[model samples]
Target: MTTVVHEFDWPDRVVIGTVGRPGERTFYLQARAGKRTASIAMEKEQSAVLAEMIDRMLDELVTADDKLSIPAEAPAELLDDAPLDQPVEEEFRTGSMRLGWDPRTAQMVIEAFPVEEEIPGSDDEALDVAAETESEPSEMLVVRIPVGTARAFAERARRVVASGRPTCSDCGMPMDEGHECAPEADA
Candidate 1:
């Protein structure tokens, strides 16, 4: 099958957002440029990790010899707190992602691939069947943003990930309305 790439370069907006309540939220990575938009469903962990990795990448760029104008923090003007665009249609569920830096353009590139559809069969049969088929994604989302926008995107992604269910102070696990913490262990 031919892969459809939703490419966005120097996008007008890109962010990680959620739908539903705190404990039952579904995370999505959305990118928009002009009238074109692409949204992909992802796990909360993925969103958090993406933000962290972006931050780490930017931090490393700050110390590089290239002396590119990397920002120490997201510029106030670029901080985007707006909710995701209307009609947030998910193109696919993300299975894997790749991140890279383009030195020539001073841009961060993000590519997300869809999860492979599972074949109906036993484990061994599934593996055999999968091997017969082409091992490539049918669709992908490619987004490129400048350094400052990348910083802002990372910051907002982190906030969205953290906005989920509050954690138990004692157990360090997510807590619902009636969640109870385990007692402290004796030294």
Candidate 2:
């Protein structure tokens, strides 16, 4: 029973949640409610309980980079009001869902739960979407950094992201990287 409760957008004062497995389908979050950057979605057991609540909320609230300021009173589940690129009608969707992403790891399915409501050719006219809401628990933005300067800047960004080096792979291009706006690749 993987825990799931995502949805971020308004935070400031230092929010830096983490968890970007980038596989299977969705589970991406490089949160920074304070600095404004955001992304959220989960399923793999709610992305392992939001990666242990973003390592205990960045080990007691961020402080290293001092740039997690994403607050403007917009946190109720802002993902543009969710519906994640819309178009999904697989009979509304039930459980045991499967369909991941790989934009370097994953973070695709922005909204999907016990949702249901398919209206295709008719197969009992599926209908379940009573109310699942990303599962629940999304109120991010808790920066308090200083854990050794955010672990020395996350060990120098995990050694420059493990140094595999292979340029040009912005699978979904969430902007901020050369300003090409990846809008989930036009969703």
Candidate 3:
């Protein structure tokens, strides 16, 4: 199997932003390294999960070493509604994501796996496809951002997620414009 890796070492900017209104928002992660830039599409859930993971990691790092200046929240002045760069075609739709600390490079590595769409029907056919595809390596997007920027990105992402439509108190699901929840459904 061939492995294709796209790496951005010490990106100048890495941020998560949305393209539409609360309920219909499309989250994207854009990283700029040197002259090349990469923008990837991810679900809102993925963004929230990534932000939560980053936040937890930053907290752990700060706790482990009191010297790290990772703040709980980014400075308000630093947060802005920056638009995604031109040619915003998604490099890939994120299927899975991971975060790691590289001691050798002293940088945090964020890797995102491309979404794999499976054709559903017969189990045998699915296994055959999976086996066939197993020989082909999937593309992964990797970015290394500064700790401060990572923290800021997490904070901004948290805000963006919270800014979504209000949730139904009973079912704990997002409420649409005319969302109706039945007492039985709540249970």
Report lDDT per candidate: 0.90, 0.32, 0.80
- Tens digits of per-residue lDDT for model 3, 102-148: 75655678999888766567799787977787864467789987676
> Which model scores highest in lDDT?
1
Runs off by more than 4 Å, candidate 3: 75-78, 119-136, 183-187
As a TM-score, model 2 comes out at: 0.20
Choose 1 or 2, whichever is better by TM-score.
1
Model 1 lowest lDDT segment of ten: 128-137
lDDT of 2 by residue, 16-62 (tens): 12233333244332334433443434344544443343344454333
Error of 3 at 82 (Å): 1.3
Which runs of model 2 end up more than 4 angstroms from their true locations?
1-130, 133-153, 166-187
State residue 54's C-alpha deviation in candidate 2, in Å.
12
Candidate 2 or 1, higher lDDT: 1
TM-score of each: 0.93, 0.20, 0.81
Query: 10 in model 1: Cα distance from truth in Å?
Result: 1.1
